[model samples]
Target: MIRKLKSGQYRIYSRKVDPKTNKRKNLGTFDTLEAAKRHEQEIQYFKHKG
Candidate 1:
């Protein structure tokens, strides 16, 4: 099983950041862990498609 983030979000590799940033940005807040992974996968798919 994949690791989890907040109950509302995902710890998606794409959404992870170092502790030195000046901003906070998360990919999406999902209703379920499954949904979060799906969102992450979709983003990667489209990102590689372009």
Candidate 2:
């Protein structure tokens, strides 16, 4: 998922919340939504490859 921060930056997070922490994992923070989405796709590709 992608979220916009108070600073106007975009953040990428895992689709599911962590069972232990009860929070979504912070994948990355980006200056733009497009950048965050691109990183999210890379993460998905690697995750599925293994």
How much does candidate 1 score in TM-score? 0.54
Model 2: per-residue lDDT, tens digit, 1-50? 99999999999888999999999999899999999989989998999995
List lDDT for all candidates, in order: 0.62, 0.93
Off by over 4 Å in 1: 1-24
Number of backbone clashes in candidate 1: 0
Which ranges of candidate 2 are over 4 A from the true structure? none
Q: How high is the lDDT of residue 50 in model 1?
A: 56
Q: Candidate 1: lDDT of 29?
A: 66
Backbone clashes for every candidate come to: 0, 0
TM-score of each: 0.54, 0.91
* Per-residue lDDT of model 1, residues 1-50, tens digit only: 23466554545444455477744455556667788778777888897995
RMSD of each: 4.2, 0.8
